[model samples]
Target: MQTKMGLKKNEIDELIDKAWKGNLERNNVIALYNVNPIILFQLADSMRKKVVGDYVTYVINRNINFTDICIDDCAFCSFRYNEGYILSIEEILAKADEAVERGATEVCIQGGLLEGMGLEDYKLIVTSIKDRFPSLHIHAFSPMEVYHAARTSEMDFRDVLKELKKAGLGSMPGTAAEILVDSVRSKICPHKISSDKWEEIIKEAHRYGIPTTSTIMYGHIESIEDRIDHILRIKRIQKETGGFTEFVLLPFMSKNNALGRIADKRSGIDDMKMHAISRVLLYNVINNIQASWVKLGLDMAQLSLLFGVNDLGGTLMEEKISKSSGSEVGEYLSPEDMEKLILKAGRIPRRRDTLYFMV
Candidate 1:
């Protein structure tokens, strides 16, 4: 059993066994990526079987980006606008109603950090939506958004999270975490929250019992080592808090953005490789490794299942962020479409809510 990369079966098994027990070192984990991609995929798929089985899950969710007006300039973003419309509380609720009409069980809302947006505004968004649809899970705000709210409102980070939880924030979206290395952060999103600060906010959310979805934006300016470093850090936090519900791998969408000038576009193989390697490295610590269909396109997303991915993210009624970055993969996927994609991959498609419970 030799692979194209000249690796042997026993060697592959040795690495896979170490990963299964969570004993693989950083170098050991990095070594997995150097093997023939087919071998890498097989071992990761095997690990995925032991960890999460063959059931593929997706959420019935909608994205409500209330505003595109952002203050900080991230080099890789095309979604921000110098002048953009901020959805009023009524407008935001109306969108949620539309999502409900479309059979969405959850609404994922995150927008640019608008000027004068305080913790109250964040709370109001959650409360207003909750008031209207008490059962709909409001997965709103990233760690940076929460940090911004705390600063604007002049409150402590933990205190802000508590207030938002009380106001009906069901969970947080782990965006704004482009790459958790400060050096990379300085180059891509220098004005954004530091990697350490993002970790702190996520830990605090876990401390307050608010579960969050974790994410990583790769293939832009970071090295392979940087990617492993970011995953290890997330693994450590999950070890401490046990709060992350899932880990989403976002390949940097590099068209029509400032960073596109210098950033290299990731190949489909690289996209699948990232998902596969992440599954092996994080193993049992983060069981749900999701493929971003919007970023990877439906075809590649389906192939990702065999590459150690188990979740298909959400059928966002409308997704603007990726489209803004010149992603022509479109913004919406119907439940039927999602089910078909999952089934075609020879896996069971289960509709999950915000917290991943089967709906």
Candidate 2:
């Protein structure tokens, strides 16, 4: 078979086999640009099967946006605001209770950086959550939040992380990372922490035995090379600390935001192709790549399964950040719906925890 781009089926298969064997070179992966979508998907699917098998992992988690108040008014964000009422400790605990009652194993608690909030406030929140739901995995905070806490508390980043961990923080959610290139970040999120700072924080987290997921937000004012650089940086870190659990690819949803006003366009097939390439390139540090159903919708997310994504993200109980960004996709998902989506894509689905363990 010859693809639309004239890439032979056997050649794609050979490349996939080499990638699985860890023998594919960077030049070989770059050569895949000549391959068409159909063959590209084929190679991605074959590689997924060879390494991770047919088990597509989904987690039972809920995103609790503790507050929308943010100091960093990123151009691409619809949730950040300098003025907004922050969630009280009682309200946060209420949300945590709701998540537990709804059968969620993980509670991803995050919020914008409030200028006056100290490390004591974060400790109070985490301690209260663990005091109530001791079993619930607390995958809270991003590097940006940590950076903020470090600054507010007038302590080093490591000290803040250590205190938070003692207060029962489990993992980092990997959101502050929009893209690791400072050039793109300077253009889009100048107020946010720099890329090097984010890397240092994540590495420090790993050093302290805290595992975290890595993420990329693409499709707005970033070059393909920037995307590649983002993945490569994560790959290098994972190589050093072996701390990343998985990689999530978030497409830029250009609507109801500043970037959207500049150019209201979402990522297309090319975006999905880059996701596939990430799975192929980060072969050593990353074993599982997740497709965000909330952003891509069910159809495109299922298509991403063929493009080297082995995970369908989570059965998010409440996802306000992405929805607030103008994603029309539903915030809640049932276990049955998750299995059905994976099966429809001709793969097996397994529920997992933050650690990617089959639950």
Candidate 3:
């Protein structure tokens, strides 16, 4: 029962037992931060196997960031442009067409919030895509976008979500939820939605039967306790609404943004630990944990799979947000490349749509 890091058999067994039975206490989860990584990784991988078996999944998707103009000044954002340009409806459709030609099943569309942008415009984007690609899963917009649309149109939030759904928005992206702690958000993204507001929007989306992904941005201006609090909030919502399809762990990329001025570099071990701990913490409540290859390189992403990650995210034909934030890895990753990386990690590779159904 001894691991490579020489941790005790009984201790590892106890933690794993707690995790499997979903009885891991907050104090014990915090204690895992000090556990030997060899033990931590083995236990996490064991839990992953129990729930998802050895099949590692990914999506052949495209990210079409229609614009870079945002009004809010988030400290960690480097993608916002003062002279933001919104793509024409024709231009947006062209990108979707290209994605379909590349064998994509989903197109993830998000952008900076533009002033005077109409709610009708958001609906138009969804309708245009669906009209052309009836079967394509349109995972468009974040909670912030929904909030913005509601404010601009002077309509109720749930009403706005319903209109977008009627216009053909298959799902929503759970961005703008940097951390579910308001104190931390004040320092990172003060102008963005509060934690309670975010939870409200997500729950509303769930009530409308619009499934969305859940996310957390870490490694910048947040404590270990803040991370735990964030996940607990997401877990509570999932227990109630069952709206989240997967949990995505995004490490803060602080190189060219305002937060980078004081942000410290995160070690690879820290990145791996977050993925492993997320799976251990959110075991039964949320099953899928994604390691973002756009942020973590292929090597670290592969290591994450052994630690507790089951999804490698999407085969994004083009990505700009991470690159704008100074991500050195290029944006485009082909399907062959994605499968190769997953195979090297010693797991079965499968392609999934936005809803986690095999495609």
Leading candidate by TM-score: 1
Give TM per candidate.
Answer: 0.97, 0.93, 0.96
Clashes per prediction? 0, 0, 0
**Clashing residue pairs found in predicted model 2:** none
By summed lDDT, the worst window of 10 consecutive residues in model 2 runs over 25-34
Each prediction's RMSD to truth: 1.5, 2.4, 2.2
Instruction: Give candidate 3's total backbone clashes.
Output: 0
Candidate 2 residues 169-279, lDDT tens each?
999988889999999999889988899999999999999988999999988888767777788788889989999999999988877689877753654677678778888
What ranges in model 2 sit over 4 Å off? 1-28
lDDT of 3 by residue, 131-205 (tens): 999999999999999999899888898899999999999999999999999999999899999999999999999
Range of the 10 consecutive residues with the lowest summed lDDT in candidate 3: 1-10
Error of 2 at 135 (Å): 1.1
Better of 2 and 3 by TM-score: 3
Off by over 4 Å in 3: 1-13
What are the lDDT figures for the candidates, one per model?
Answer: 0.90, 0.84, 0.90
Q: Candidate 1 at 105: error in angstroms?
A: 1.2
TM-score of 1: 0.97
